[model samples]
Target chain A: MSAPPTPPDPTSDAAMTRRSFLRGTAAFGGLTALAASLAPLRELSDFSSTEQFLQKYYKEMTPSDMAKVIARIEREVQHQYGVRPHVRDLKPMDGVEFVYCLNLTRCIGCRKCVHACVAENNQSRNPEIQYIRVLKMPHGSMDVEKGDHNYKDAQVPDKGFFYMPVQCQQCKNPPCVKVCPVNATWQEKDGITVIDYDWCIGCRYCEAACPYFARRFNFTKPEIPKDRLNPEMAYLGNRPRKMGVMEKCHFCIQRTRAGKYPACLEVCPVGARKFGNILDPESEVSHILREKRVFIQLKEEMGTSPRFYYYFDK
Target chain B: MDPRPTRPGNSKSSRTNLWLGGLTVGFLGLAGLFLAGTRSPRPARADIPPVDKKFLETTPWRQTYADLVKAKEDLSDYDCYGCHEKNKPPPIRFDDKGKIIIPKEHANIVMGHGSHDRNDLCYNCHNEQNLETLQVRDGRQVKFDNIPLLCGSCHGPTLRDWDAGAHGRTSGFWDRKLGEAQRLSCANCHNPHSPRIPPREPAPGPHTLHETTPPAQPGH
Candidate 1:
């Protein structure tokens, strides 16, 4: 569609030689600078190729493959923490759909559950990663925006205000799992949304997608003391996460799988937290759902279908 | 081959006798060792306090609830029957303004129930005849552990909620097949005399993402 180029003039040969020499020098200089800057990236190349890139989709892996992967993770944790962790891949229990109910009237605004969760989950201590965030809301109001999360009161159950502790709702239709680009997060059969730390590319798409603000991104390597490190861990739950990953409460998978309550439920001083399988009619959570005026957070037309419920006595 | 070598003292019976003697010596040696082991002293006991029987029966998670009763027992020095058995105290004593007067014995008690105007008399909850146990609307005696029955007569809705797992703290297994569930008594959380829970220090709240200062507000 365009015209052909004209022939080069014989007299411009010297100019052409000089132009090529300058271009060559500039290209060489750029390459040298790039190699210097990228020197640190070479160390991370092994992690990318061996772990992240090679990780198959969770559903694609066979049982034998999962065992090998769990073994490798156990070795890596032992090397990093100098502690032999019991990393297990616990499947969902049959006929067990976990649900949690919190009594708003009895919660004394005690943050014991927060600290207990951190200790049990092996959360970063210095950066202070906690799953449960108790909001202090005023009396006769359910608006979380009007609530103060950083209240430092001399006494709790303050005359005109009440406390509402919020955490992962463990929604049946979790937005966090839906938004994971690499399928790094998914809901287990037992109604817990779990994250595969090594597979996550730290895109933070799930963090943005979560309606409950439940997902937490590991901006840096989680710093926990050697003494405080919880040796008990789960492959898809509370195992030590690498830097640049996403994690949230998995309902204490390590303990709950062993037929024990979550650390938060056990540590609550007022026994406000109630946890049980919703499948059983005789469960405390079932009783609460059937009898109490149970309510969920962000119960709009969004329809996340959360498992967490809050109720108060008349 | 040995048919002709049979002798009276050096027969096969002599070899069998030697084996039996060795077995007898080994058995006696083992018996002596066992007797020596049993003579050793047992390990010394640690100076730990006696564990409460209630705590031992209940799960460890419910130990805090058990501690509430233990703490009350530690402080309850005044016996209710000490004066009630010997001397007859006035059941109701009102001043000229019809305000309830605190007797010398109950002057230390703080009555902070907000609705004191309607039911201010002590006999409303405590039995005038028997001061040890609480009384219900139908004049039925209820133990301290069964205070919910007495409280339910007046607070029918609250009692219903409590039974339905809507009110009070229930600790232990949700499944009855796994373990026993322990519901805390009313007196575990609230003071019986005052009823109103006093204000206490709240645990530290959540640290915000940016650590921004909370907006200044009235009555914070």
Candidate 2:
């Protein structure tokens, strides 16, 4: 160079290059930080596959599409649990509306129904996911807030305490169904609130929306023992759910739709849990609704209009 | 236009100090989160029973008297003809205080029928005329399988509830159009000798995910 160049004036265009260089450096650093922050996404354990990502909504799926989807699920289940599960998408029966009646006096606070539900449904054993929560309420009290489910008594029917098992009420006007931003959950014609696990974005808005605390979140990949996995699964019922999805008691869609009593009803030693079609005048549930005194719906003030009813036959 | 004005607090040295403080706080927060995330799960309570095969097994202790009779090959095991004459009712001895002295041979039968032990007489349920038949209050004869009829005579309200499916277990199918609805008889659940159902051990409570302590009451 002929002569050393003098320092550029602070106000001159000559200083623009330095300023631009610093700006470029800042931009590069910001981009690198953003990339580093997003690195955790690569380790997503339950990332959706291309097929699952592209799957249509439950209502939109045709019979053929449903069959293909079921087959794919069956294959995936076989690969994971080493067992081929029979996954069928059962449609709601015409002229049938399900109603459940619980005889509060007959329930002896025995949690047999709870365990039976877990065994019937392919729920995770560790970090156990149970739909039914049997609350032990004090005598002369109907308030649910005063109830406790964690009492570890040597024998049930604890003195001065009665039992009330709570689950999805299957509301006529379901708040959970309405709050779903993704429309992943809906009430079927049979009055059963069903969740489409595939379409769920794991927002947990429905869980918050529910007043009875019925919905459960798959916080992690469900850990069910191979032997404990129920092979008789329905697509929107007892089928094994993946991580980051919402699930709840579907009133045993697979069994009830096929005209079989739910596992909870079958196992209840006291015969407290009663389920039947309200449409049939001769049905047991109809007779119960007509005859039983002191019948009350859980949280009727919430305007949920639950299909489930509790009665005291004194 | 220059958006940031040079204030006393926004000086170069103060700004650098603020950046250092922010970085340190961020690092500490991340470290705390990492520790919390990596912490081991709380040990399960020893008082809680493990959900084993026995705990999970559900044997509905309700078998109809008719079904039990049909299953038994030896009718004499439950038949009145085994110990007494077929047509005549067996003679029962009474103590001085009017309590029936149950024979040692039938020690298995506990006579605690009513709340105050009022309906404990053998002839009250079993027919004195014909030992094979059950006697209702109206003298209507009921078979062993139709014990609900015999029990219904006294427990009219319970009988009405049972008839309307408000009482007793109705298993099988809820919809009778599709399958049979198997309704359990009254004697299936309650022992005729002792009508009160005994207390039973409840199944294990819920073990929630990532909870160190016992699961807090849900939805409270």
List RMSD in Å for every model shown.
26.8, 8.9
Residue-wise C-alpha lDDT for candidate 1, range A58-101, written one tens digit per residue: 77889888887888777777776788888888888888899989
How far in Å is the alpha carbon of B14 misplaced in model 2?
35
In candidate 1, how many Å is residue A10 off? Answer: 47
In model 2, the Cα lDDT at residue B61 comes to 67
Docking class of 1: incorrect
Runs with alpha carbons beyond 4 Å of true place in candidate 2:
A1-48, B1-50, B54-58, B86-88, B211-220
Q: Score residue B52 of candidate 2 by CA lDDT.
A: 62
What tens-digit string does per-residue lDDT give for candidate 2 at A1-314?
A: 59887656655655554335445445554555555455545435244566777899999999998998898889888888899899989999999999999989889888888888988988877667899999999888789998988878889888888899999999999999999999999998989999999999999999999999999998877778888889999999998888889999999999999999898898888889888889989877888888777468999999999999998877
TM-scores for every candidate against the unseen true structure:
0.71, 0.81
lDDT, model 2 = 0.81
